[model samples]
Target: MYRIQEDHLDINQLTQALTESSSECGAIVTFVGRVRGSSEKNRSVKEIYLESYLSMTNKAMMEITEEVQLRWSAVEKISIVHRIGVIGLCEPIVFVGVSSKHRKDSFEAASFIMDQLKISVPLWKKENIEEQGWVWVSAKPSDKQAALRWRL
Candidate 1:
């Protein structure tokens, strides 16, 4: 599921959603994204404001979720939630979870979703810093490279 909210996410709810009922899975990979205090130059940040096209954002995420299912045979569950609007420092921004019969597939798929979300998702963040003023930010080349690896 996708959302654009100001309230904090419930981790227990996410964990419950990710837990699979089937006994075939041995590993459940999870990646949690939090608002970082560092910027492009590793400067300290006070906060970040995230914006996005709500309708399109959910559609894109669902596409990635479907791709995760198609790319790995053992994947049993996938859950991703991204928050938008004014985000506080060190707060959770996104959550990615995947379950698989083996560790390798679950890890890889979980990593792939995180990378793709960073690059492909149409989310924008404006950094609020103490020394400097607010500045809008976009996906970096390193993030693009991370997403590229999955396509290859």
Candidate 2:
């Protein structure tokens, strides 16, 4: 499942849904990403405005989920939920959940999904800084490097 919403994310609901998706799964791993107060640009972030090319972003997320299952055959289901619009500091921005027959597969699949989302998804973010005002966030080299580690 892939979702892009303008409301706050319900982490519990997402995890619960994934847990009930399959009876064969023994392990479920989830990753929750939140907006931080301080960023690498040394700006004090007040809020963040997120937007996405909805159709394309959702497509990419689905593709990433499919890739996870292809790489980890034990993975039963994957769910990704990303929040758009203005989000306050310390609020959840995204969620990735994976269910598998074992802990290793679940953990690895969740991690891979998150890394790929960061680099491949068409989501854009604007930071409302305390002093500098709203500024568009740029891609980080570290994020690209992380995604590169998963090359087939």
Index of the highest-TM-score prediction: 2
TM-score (C-alpha) between model 1 and the true structure: 0.92
Give the Cα lDDT of each candidate.
Answer: 0.83, 0.90
For residues 1-152, write the lDDT of model 1, one tens digit per residue. Answer: 54556678787788787774389988888888898988878888998988889888877888888898889989988878888888888999887888888989899999989898888778888999878889888678999898998888
Candidate 2 residue lDDT tens string, 13-117: 988899785678899999999999998878799999999999899889889977887899999888899999999999999999988899999999888988999
Worst 10 residues of 1 by lDDT: 1-10
Off by over 4 Å in 2: none
| Shift in Å, residue 108, candidate 2 | 0.6
- For candidate 2, give the lDDT of residue 79: 89
Question: Candidate 2 at residue 11, lDDT?
Answer: 93
Q: TM-scores across all candidates?
A: 0.92, 0.96
Candidate 1 stretches greater than 4 Å from native: 1-4
lDDT of 2 at 36: 96
